[model samples]
Structures are given as C-alpha cells and as structure tokens.
Target: MSSLVPPAPAPALPALLTTVLPALESLTTALGIPRTVLASDEEIEYAWKDLPRELREIPAPLRGELVARMCVAVSTGLFDSAMNYIWNAAILQLRAKIRNFGVPIVAQILQSDFEERNLVELQDSRLLELSLKLNIVNEDGFFFLDQCRDVRNNFSAAHPTIGTINDREFTTFLNRCVRYALADASSPRGVDIGAFISAVKGARFNSSQNDVWVQRLSETHDAQRQMLIIMVHGIYCDPNTSEPSRLNALDICGALNSGFTASLRSELVHKHSEYAAKGDEPRHTASLQFFERLGLLINLNESEQHAIFYRAIERLWTVHNGMNNFYSEPPFAERLLELSKQSAIPETIQDQFVQVVMCCVIGNGYGVCRAAVSSYEQLIRSFSPREVALMIGLAATPATTLSRRISSHLSCSQRFKQSLTLIDPASVPSSVRATYDYYTR
Candidate 1:
C-alpha cells in the first residue's frame, strides 16, 4: 500500500438536547408537545446538562420534566417556550414545597390573583415572588426568576412577540430554571468555625468530611467568617501550628470569600493598626504582605479582582516608593518582584504602573529602582512589541528628569532591550528617542 495520510474525519455534529437532558424528550413525547414547529437552522444547539453544575438537588419528577423542557427550549433557541417551561417548573416546585407545609402557604401564593382578577392561578411572577418571601430562593436567584418572567411575558409561546432571542438570552433563561426552580437543596450541613479552626490547629485535612465542610464553608457566611477568623488568628495563635496546615488553610481561604479584597481588607487593616500603634511594625508586616500574596490566589470575580490587583500594586508602590531608605530598600525591592507577577492588570494600567515604577523610584536616583527593573521579569516579558514602541513614544515629550529616569531604567533592563528590538526604532516615542539612543549605545 502506498504511504498516504488519511483525510481528517468529518467534524462531528452537536447532539440535540435529548442526549443531554433525556427527560425533556420523554416529557415532550408524553405531553405531545410539538418542538418541530419552532425548530430551524438558526436554532443554536448547546449541551444543556452540564451548564448548571451549581445545582444542589434535582427537582421532583413532574418539575424535572418541566426543567428538562426548559433546557431543551433554551439550547435550541426556542426562548419563548423556554420561558413557559421554566415558569411551569417554578410553579410546580413552589407548590410542592408549600403542600408539604399546608394551605396557608398556598393561600398566600394565590393572594395576588384573588385580590386582582377574581381568580387564583398561582401565576408565574407571583409564585416566584412568594418563593423569595419563603426563603426558597436567594436575592440573586429571585432576580433571575423575575427577569425570566419578564422575558417570558413578552416572548411567551401563548402570545406573539416583537422581540427575538439569541444565545445569550436563552442562556439567561436556562440559568433561572436551574438555579431556582429545580434546585431543592438550599441549606448547608453543620460545619462551623470551631470545627474548622480546631481541625486546622490540630494539622488535619478535614478532607474526608470535605463534602460537608467544604460545601458548608462555600455556602454560609457565618462558616466563612469563622474560617477567616481562624486564618487571621493563626498569626496570633499558637505557633505550634504546622506549615502544611497553614498552606492548606490558604486553599480553604481562597475558597471562602467572594470579594477577596473586601473580605481580607478589614483584617489586614486591623493588623496594620494594631502593630503600627504598638510600634511592632515588623510583627504586623506579614499581614500587609498577605495582600500581595493572597490577592493572587483568590477566586474573586473578574472586574473586582482586576481592580483589587491595581489597588494592591499602587499600595505597595506607596509603601516602597523606591526610596532606598533604611526601611524601604530591600523589602520594597522584594515587593516590586511581586508586582512583576501582576500581568492580569489591563495594559492601560500596566503602562502607568511601569512608568510609576521607573519614575518614582529610579527618578529619585535610587539604585533600588534600577535593580528592581530587571527583577520585573514577568512584567518585562508581558510587554508586547507595540507596548515597547509606546514606551519609546514617551521620550517624544520634553527631556525632563522623569523622562531620563524612565530612559535609564529602560537602558538598564536587558529584558526591555530585547522587546524594544522587536519593533522598528523609528516607531519608538519621540521623547524616548534620545533615551533609547543613550541606552542602546
């Protein structure tokens, strides 16, 4: 046989939602629902089953069928139907929860219908509103349900709509169902501070009970705060605690809070005050240092995380300021290396931070800035060719001391030199030209 490369296999087709949410197909068949009436080439199919893994407990059978139908409708771009299915699921879940208690809850749910239209239908919006009152849904979960109902009303299968649903809209619709309507388990088990702190103090993983402890830690604020208190208390607690326990505590710490900065900032500031007031700055230095360290590891949301990173760099810069003073030099130099790892900062802020590092420290003629520039290996490596050109463009301004200091730092760093060479020297900043010349020579 001739040696010939086989052709690449045909791209596999995406599975219909039936494969992902089998209950949906079965439900549709049982209800004699006609999904084909709305099916079209524009219907963008995505796997729906794995989309909402935060789901704690699946709904009862009747409600699950509705949830599955919602999943299928959303994945296939039948947003109008998706809304109705989600609404129906919400109603069923609420009724089931209430029926377990009594008619008082049902009476409350139908109060709005009885008051307004001489009828009680357990309406979608009212049922969701009552779900919030009953604490069946959190604030965020309720917001999603309310929004789903609004979209459902305007683009419902029972009525004509002036709007269209894209993938994003359908994704939102699908999420409401998964998060609120089908979710049955809302409370975490009884893992609290005493358990967590005692475990950590004793050098145990608590991993065997992680399902209970981790979920409890992840879900409850009281549990999270207790965990944080222990993490902070470790600084003051018995040093008999092992390093492994401390390291593992950080993994738990990273998991506990939503806003990394917000959660840790108060404790950090308190530590700073306590030490700084007692003339024990060195004892407290670790708390301040934790910001630079832990901020990197936290699982904060994107925008807030980015803001915290920028703020952290600026704060470190303020404390260090490239002064080369008895208190500032070596420690500041070390912290500056920490700055180099903050590559997630947007390029706009990146340039400004670099400029500050160059001008604020080296501008004062401190060897620390010059030495620190090379240590900014991660930061230097992050600079794009275009960014290097922008740095040169800065030289186009009048040759002030700030300009010269930036130039001097540029000249001193071998990393920046390599990045500069990647772009045409003519593209460099006009004010940066002489600095480039002086440095390159």
Candidate 2:
C-alpha cells in the first residue's frame, strides 16, 4: 500500500520551512482549508508568487490553502508533501463539485470497472485519470495531473525518491497544480438544479422538442448527467407539485428514462434514508411524497416501505408488466418478505398480489423468481389462502396447461395443503381434485 504519511523531513529542514513559511505568507492571501488538513502548525503560508496567469480550467476552491501548503513543502525540500498537496487539491475540487465528502467522485465514475474487479480501494493516479472522464478535470488537465503523479511518486514525501525536483521544476509543477487542480473560479454554468426546478415549476416547455433536453443530457459527461438525473428524480418525487412546473418536470422525467429505473431502484434505500432525516416529510401526498411514496420509490431497508411498495406493485401489476425482477432475485426478495411480513394488504386486491407472486413461482419469463422460493412462499402466505381457493376453482374449469400450472403452483404451497379444508371435494373437477391430491400426497 502506498503510504500517505511522508517521511520526516531531514533534521535541518524544519527551521528552513518555518522561516520561509512566514515570509511566503506576505506574498498573498488564502482562505485556508479545514483545520484538519493543515500540514503544519506554523503561521499561515503565502500564495504562489508567480502562480500561472493562463490555464483557465477546472476550479479548485481551496487554491489558497493548496498553494500555501505546496509552497511550504517545496521550500523545505519536502517534495513528497508538495505532491500530496497537488493530489489533495484535485480531490478537493471533486468534493466541491459533487458535495460528496469521502471517496472521490472518480470512484463513482469508474464504479462498474472497480466493482467488477473488486478494486474497492484506488490510488491517486488512477483516480486522477478517472476524473478526466468525470469532467472533474479535463483531458489536458489529466496530462498535467499525470506528471504531478510521477513527480510526487519520485520526489514527494509519500515514497522514497532517488531524484530531486529543483526550484525550476518545482515551480512548473506548482503552476500546473494551480492551473489544473486549483484554478480559483466558479463552476461554468450548466445545469443548475435550483434554476431548472424553478423553470419546471413554471411549466416552461416552450421548446418544440422536450427530447432536446434529454438529448443534451445524454451528450453531457456522465457525472454532470448523473447530477441532473438525481436532481430531476428529486423533482419528480417532490411533494409540492402544486405548480405548472410539475407537469413540465414529469414530461422531462418521462423523456429521460434512460436506464434510470434500475438506477433509481439502487438508490431507493439511500434516498429514503435522506428523507427520513429531514424535518418535513410528505406523508399524505401521493406524487410528491419522498420516503413514503409507493411503487418504484419504495425503500426496501425500511419495513414500513414494503407495504407501500407492494401496494404499488399491485396497482401497477398487469399480465403485461410487473416488478422488473429487482425483488424477485434472492436476497432482495428475502429483504422484501421480511419488511412486508406484517404489512396490511387490502383484501380486495389480495389475489392480484398473489397472482404476481405466482408468476414468479411459475418463472414465466426467466427463473429470476426461482432464486428465492422461500421469500415468495412467505409472501404467498399473506393472500395464498384466498388465491389457492380461486385456483382450486380455476383448476376444475379447464385442463389447459395454464390452469394446470396454476393448480401445480397451488399444490406446491405448503400453506395450500394445510388450508385444504377450505376447499370442498365437490368444488373442483374430479380429475383436478385427484391431481391436487397426488401433488399434496
């Protein structure tokens, strides 16, 4: 593992760093970073004297703090510390852009690759490269960051250095650091969630093509697009859609369904957790409610959420469409069953719920539901008695394969056997009754 702590600077270095740190403080002003990130307890360090004039690129808000630290590092010949400052400045920019506190947004940009290989941990260089893709840093910025990585590895405090970075090279790296990693500027105007929400709320759909927005969204970098998607999702679920913008927002959401259903499912638990912590929750509203919304917005982590989710599942369930196998898969279904165990389901639509479960039991499409038979069994226990009773009647009416599968599924349920007393021998066809008997036995 690469060590983050730099080796103690040479014994003679402290006094030099202490003296120059004070002198540099006179060069420029800086709004220092969090106290925790301070490299030394010495007096506030100064800004770069000749920090480059060009290199208008990604904005790093902590430029003053970074310059101070880097100056202290290079002045004292603490090459490693200097590199660490550059690397951290990049991280600070990413954090500022996404509002994510830990694990740089680069990790998310490369989520699929990292997850596939189980590379849960990443190094600074790889993260910097991935940042290019995220637009956290541009392609040109990536080249300078790559050089910074090399210099930091070879000359910075993190690892042993056989070579030295002299004043000229150190200054060049500092300029690159300032330009690429710590440009002190605001983000370029793109998608402002607040402004866009205001527009949506006002129903500003004057553009002939709503698809134009989605197309623009598709063309943007993934990180920015994802940010917009998340913002729109929040809007789509907002409780105060009493304005015209709500319709405009819904139109945008309908247009931007690019694999977002699956993404939304993945985020349900976290989003609910967010809503739970907030003071204002929209419990009574249907469309705008956050944590308590039914349907695709359900949070499986909260047992209370399942009742709403399953209720929506029933409302949306048709022979043509159903829950898209998110819960039918094993551990997820187990989680669903556990959450909904004591859930109060309406008796009127109970069989509809049972029918969906039966669809899984039958594995009509893929064997997705087959992976968690136990979860489905527990779910069936809620309305299976009524459904099995109906299936008993359906079984007697026809000898068709679909009816037989229904009969077979009913016979497969252990609860069905114990509830057999609910059915009369006269109620079902003689042949179907014998078939049920054979399966039960």
The residue pairs found clashing in candidate 1 are: 392-429, 393-429, 395-430, 395-431, 395-432, 396-430, 396-431, 396-432
Q: Which parts of model 2 are misplaced by more than 4 Å?
A: 1-147, 150-189, 192-195, 204-209, 261-268, 276-306, 309-352, 355-390, 393-441
Top model number, TM-score = 1
- Cα lDDT over the full model 1: 0.53
In terms of lDDT, model 2 sits at: 0.52
| Pairs that clash in candidate 2 | 79-156, 80-156, 80-157, 200-245, 201-245, 238-288, 239-288
- What TM-score, computed on C-alpha atoms, does each candidate reach? 0.36, 0.35
Q: Go through the candidates in order and give the clash count of each.
A: 8, 7
lDDT per residue for candidate 2 within 1-441, as digits (tens), equals: 897975323222234445665544443335444432333333221222233232223333354586567656655445457767766776556545433321333344444433323222456676676567567678888888788878777777667776655545665776777677566444432344445556666656866646666665655554566667666656655775654555565567656553455555455445655665674466223333333323333334434444565655544333224555535356555544643553444455454555555554445423334466666666655544445555554434455333555456544344435434444555545535665675457
